[model samples]
Target: MSKTRNPNLDVIRCLAVLLVIVIHFFLNTKFYDVTINSWQLEIMVGMRTICMICVPLFMCLTGYLMHEKELSWEFYHKLWPTLSVYLQSSALIYLARIGIFRERLSLADGVLGIFSYSTAPYAWYVEMYIGLYLLIPFLNMIWQGCQTRGQHQLLVATFVILCILPTFLNIFGKMIPDYWVTLYPLAYYFSGAYIHTYETEVTQIPLRLVTLMIVLLSVMHNLNASAGRIFQWLPMNDFGSSEIYALTIVIFVGILKARLPKTIGDIAKYIAPYTFAMYLVSYIGDQLIYPIFMNWFKTESAMLAWMAVPILLIFIGSLLLAIAQKLFWQLLRVCLDKFWQKYQVL
Candidate 1:
């Protein structure tokens, strides 16, 4: 709402965004988690834990900026822009896929998978984002209708409870036909929507400090137990221990908002903006760029390529997608103007 960005929020977004990239980054190199080699293990564990916050934080940002007391036609009016981006991204993805897969892929797979992101190349997040955009007005109803903090917390708790149940019964993982995104991501979406709609800044006082301690404990929990898969109790997945993840995120944001514009804060914001583009082009990096180069390291030639290649690939790929998105947004704006002219109100 202000002309200036909140360096604090931006920093959080940036770090959360890059954690998503770090997932693939670790996958591409010598990040296997054998005990004697634990530096990469730390990276792998940290990344896995951090990524739990990414989408939730994004939706919280969405709810923070866009929520309103009443569902408006204006929400419906934004549809063309969101749809246009989604469609353009899908098209770009298809082209990228064709380039990558070339002759080995079939026309039918292309036709179906173009819109289906789990099947498509790294496009699942974008698809879920578009899906969330379509649901905003309904979520707006929930956010706006909750008249008290208690009510808001109740609703969010209900959402988390439903999302977590299947895991206990093996329902979320197996009995539930579509486990990963559909039921599970709702906890993130619901908690984010509720918090943004209800709370201001981060929690204050002893609660805030206690939350930070809890976050550290949770991170260490994962770090110490990732090899055993016991720490998989953390809700990075649909059936993740969402209570811990949500609490951890809440705590981190408090510290984040307070100390920004420093090195960590700036990078946290700067790196996140390109996460969408990075996802779009990550396979390109992983398969084509990083693997061929970064994986060649044997410690004799230096581990330099491991870091350099992933960063370079992410930067170049994100730059091109950013340009495309800018142009696409401009086109969407023109479309909006035309629609406004026809409707007399926008």
Candidate 2:
């Protein structure tokens, strides 16, 4: 039997994807004539900055769920679908872009892109996930070897110091050695596992306090981005390293602790199954629809209302697409199951 779904994790996944959509909507698109000093600009920018947590949160969720799973045929069986989606989405996106540009599709580039180490736009998350998928067994082995919670916490802390901290220091013009590139996804991945395994009710940080810190840090990040953009000469501390990851952990913890109403839990279950497909749908919209929307709405004279319309449209449209895909997949799965049952030896 399939494992029971965790409602909290499902809620977190939906929230993360929605946050990502918000970021894509406003990150480059100009918002309604708002100057750097405007309150609206700060809110928009701050929210975008804060929502950067979504990516790391995705990594965290992966670690939480998969870190303990054995590296066996069963693991690959689960992992293959994600790999297939990445390949399919990248190809579909390339095709869509070429068609939009009215350019000839280069067959060689399309095939090569499947194997390319370089990340396609908005597809970097999948690339990182692929890397982590390969290493999860070894990672779990190491986690299993830890005799005490303190040891696991210590290892995660060491990664934060040696690998994660330098990312923050980069804002101050400090650079770490190049070899440290091997550490990342590792830092976030193991930290997620550590949080899941070692963090307990007794050790839990208060959600209220974490929420307050997220707001305060978001304001700071917003200010940093604004100053860099407005002054032109100042550095933007846009590294988004520590604060993003920190907020992600808090959010994960908060979700873990939440007891949602039955109504919300049902809704989460309904939507959660389509989230991966929604991500792919939203990404295509990000590439294709966003530019078109920007052309019509990105004027200095545009109202804040107008600025919001595209985000709403893209989000809703992606959901509709996800729903349709979910229905289609359900049908396809039924057919496949019937075929297998008829053909296979019991």
Candidate 3:
């Protein structure tokens, strides 16, 4: 049997996901809803600024749980379920878009759609994550030899290189870096896995100092982006980033560490399995649900409704996706077992 993994990590992951959902729901609703309200617009921008840290935090978590044991074709077997989830959701979404959006489709589009990285728009992170997972054996092999202290040092050094290198290349804009040149987001996973395997504890440091550093870095990062400058001083600009951004992720991890666990076996089991599913479903909601909600509420910007509406939708959407994924997995497992049972008897 596999060893029991970190319990707190799950809760932290759940929170990070929620933050992403919360930020997206609010940001999209504010920006795209039928009519824009001033207050809601400002709040959306503000929340967008705060929520920007979600992905970075996610990267940090991925690093924290470094199960760098071995690499095999078998390691990829876990992705099959996730792969199934992606396929099913894509089919459902494509059908819905065709039916509701009145968007035209062709056989070529369907072919391209299948190779989609994640859900539809968020596919980049999804496909890339599986890619990184596949490489874990090699990365772990390199990491395992280093002492704990060495691993931590490597992470810091890697962070600096990943963060700055992109900026230098990007100095010339689209012509220089292009698509393939970007790898910072991928670096986050490496950073996270490195920490989990090597970095001993976040608790040893004082919380205030940690908080200050996170805030400072995140601010500088965002300011650079808003200024239309050449270099984005933060982590992972393509997926959305700011300089102080990674710092915020670290700070949030510290906060997560301080909080008590809010979930047990069942609740944990319920939310944990669906995290990716929810990630996929949220995109659907972003494209479809928010549009309808925007049309319905007709809320003015700068109003509390702007903030409240998206948060509610995100929570509901994520919760529903989590539940649906669990049931789907449960049914699939049962059916598979039955098939084997029949085969054995035959």
Q: Whose lDDT is greatest here?
A: 2
The reply for model 1, stretches above 4 Å from the true place, is 1-7, 29-39, 69-73, 100-103, 106-111, 118-120, 164-182, 206-212, 228-240, 262-275, 298-305, 324-346
Reference-based lDDT, each prediction: 0.58, 0.69, 0.60
Model 2 TM-score, 2 decimals: 0.82
Better of 1 and 3 by TM-score: 3
TM-score of each: 0.70, 0.82, 0.75
Candidate 1 accuracy as TM-score: 0.70
Candidate 2 vs 3: which has more TM-score: 2
Candidate 2 structure quality by residue, lDDT tens digits, 1-346:
9988779888988887787787777654754234566555655666666777777777888888777888788887888777765655566556665775455658777677667722236766676677778889989998888888789888887777666666666666767543463465677888778777765842366777867776697568657656535511122222225666677777788888888997888887777766766676676577656677767765434534565676667777777866765566668789999999988956
- Over 4 Å off, model 2: 1-3, 31-37, 98-101, 117-120, 173-182, 228-240, 299-303, 323-346
Sort by lDDT, best first: what order? 2, 3, 1
Candidate 1 per-residue C-alpha lDDT over 227-296 given as tens digits, one digit per residue, 9 for 90 to 100: 5432244333322454344553564446444755478666655555555554565565556666565546
The 10-residue segment of model 2 with minimum total lDDT is 231-240
Please write out the lDDT profile of model 3 over residues 1-346, one tens digit for every residue.
9977655667666666777787666556545333322444444444555566666676666655644658777777766877777776676556656776766876568558768642266666677677766776776776666666766567555654655345444555632333433555545656666555434564555677766665555444444444432223233333423343455556555654565555553465557656766776677677766776767766553345655666667767767855766677679889999999999999
Off by over 4 Å in 3: 1-5, 30-42, 100-102, 106-108, 164-181, 198-201, 216-245, 261-269, 296-304, 325-346
**Candidate 1 steric clashes:** 4
